[model samples]
Target: MPESELGGPEEKSYTAPGKVPLDSGWVDVPRLSLSASAGPGAFGGEERPFDNFRFSQRWLREQGLDGSHLSAITVEGDSMEPLLRAGDEVLVDHSPQPFRDGIHVVRLEDTLLVKRVAAQGGGRYSLLSQNLAYPPLEVNAQDIEIVGRVVWKSGRL
Candidate 1:
C-alpha cells in the first residue's frame, strides 16, 4: 500500500478475510464522497462513502467520541479560511443533539455548507463565515438541517 493508504506504524494483525482485526487498536472511519462548502454552497447529494481515514481507537475514546458515529468529509471553499481552509478534511460527529454555538455542517435548501452556527434567538441562527468577505447569513431554524457537528479538522501547513 502507498504511504497515504497506510495507518500508523503499528503492524496490522488479521483475524479472517474481509473482517476487521480483533485488536488493531485503530479504526477506519469512512470518508463520504460529498463535501461541505465553506463558501458558496455545494450540492447536498446522497451519502456515498468513498474512502476511509484511520484513527486510534483509544484517542477517539479519550475525546469522548464514538468511532461508529464519525465520518469524514472534505472542505470545498475558502469562506472558512484562517480556521478551516479549502481541501481540509473534517470529522463529523453524527450524534443527535441540540445545536450549540460552533462549527457545524448544515444543509440549507439543496446545498450543504460548513459554517460557524450561532443561535440568534427566536428560532433563528446566524451562519457566519471566518472570512469577512462573505456576509453572514441569518436563517430560521426550520429552514436549515443540521447534518452534524465538526468535531475535528485536519489540514496541511
Candidate 2:
C-alpha cells in the first residue's frame, strides 16, 4: 500500500475529534448573566459575563458595530416569537445609536426586556411585541433606559 493512499504521519490531526477548533477570524463576545424578558419582564440583576459567544469580526465591522460595546443575553419568553424565541442568545450592541425603530434591549423600571422599540415623538417610545397576545407598552424617556440594540441572535431553526 502506498503512503499517500494510507493515512501518513504528516497528516496528523492537531484538534481532537468532536471538538471545534478556535478560529482567529472570530471574536469572543461576552455572554452576560442577565436574561432579557421577551414576555412580561425579568429583573435586571447580576451585571456580569458568565460565558462568551463567538462572532465574526468582519461581520461586526460590516454592520458598523464595535465588539467592545457588545454583549450577549438570553431571551426568556415567547412574546417576541417568530422573530426571537425563548432561550435564544441575542447579541446586544451597547454602542450609542440613533433611537430608531428596531429590536432593542431596554430597562423598564427594575426589569429588563427585549422588544421592538418605536419612536412615538416628543421623547416617548412604545415597546411592541411580535406576539399579538401581548399589548404594546408606551413609555416615556424618563421611565425607560435603552440598554442596547439587538444586533444578532443565535437559535435553532
Candidate 3:
C-alpha cells in the first residue's frame, strides 16, 4: 500500500474516517448566522447556525460555561465602541435567569441592541454605551426582552 493510504510512522490513526478526534480536548460551539447589532438594527429573524468555533472543554468549564449555554453572534455597528467594537464576535449565554448588570443582548421595541445593562431596581434597566455620543436609555423591565448575557467578546486588535 502507498504511504498516503497506509499508516506511516509519523501519522497515527486514532479516529474513524470523516470524524474529528475528540481526544484532542476540544469542543465546538455553534456560530449563529444571525447578527446582533451594537447599534440599532433588525430585531428578530431566522437564527440558523452557519459555523462552529472550537474551544477546550476544560477552559470553558473553568469559566463556568458550557456549550449548551453558549452561542456566537457577530456584532454590528459602533454604538458600543471602546468595549465592543463593530464587527466583533460575541459569545452569549442563553441560560434562563434574571438579568444582571453586564453587557447583554437586548430587544427593545422591534429592535435588537447590544449594550451595557445596569439593574436600576423597580423593574427597570439602563442601557448604556461606551461611546459618549450615544446617550444612555432607561427602559422598563417589561418593555425589553433580554436575549442573553454577553460573556465574552473577540475581535481583531
Those runs of model 2 whose alpha carbons end farther than 4 Å from true positions after fitting are 1-23
Q: Candidate 3 on 1-157: residue-level lDDT in tens?
A: 2233455642644455434455567777788877777776656566788887888889898988887788898888888888888888999888888667999998888777889999999998999988888889999999999999999888999
lDDT of model 1 at position 56: 92
Writing each residue's lDDT as its tens digit, candidate 1 over 1-157 gives 3222355344452244433563668888999988899998999776898878888999999988889899999999999999999999999999877678999999999999999999989999999999999999999999999889999999899
Ranking by TM-score: 1, 3, 2
Please list all clashing residue pairs in model 1, or write none if there are none: none
Give the range of the ten consecutive residues with the poorest summed lDDT in model 3. Answer: 1-10
TM-score of each: 0.86, 0.83, 0.83
- Tell me the lDDT of candidate 2: 0.88
lDDT by residue for model 2 over 1-157, one digit each (tens)? 3233346553553544333344446777899999999999999989898877777889889999888899999999999999999989999999886777899999998999999999999989999999999999999989999999999999988
- Under the 3 Å rule for N, CA and C atoms, how many clashes does model 3 have? 0
Q: Rank the candidates by lDDT, best first.
A: 1, 2, 3
State which candidate has the highest TM-score. Answer: 1
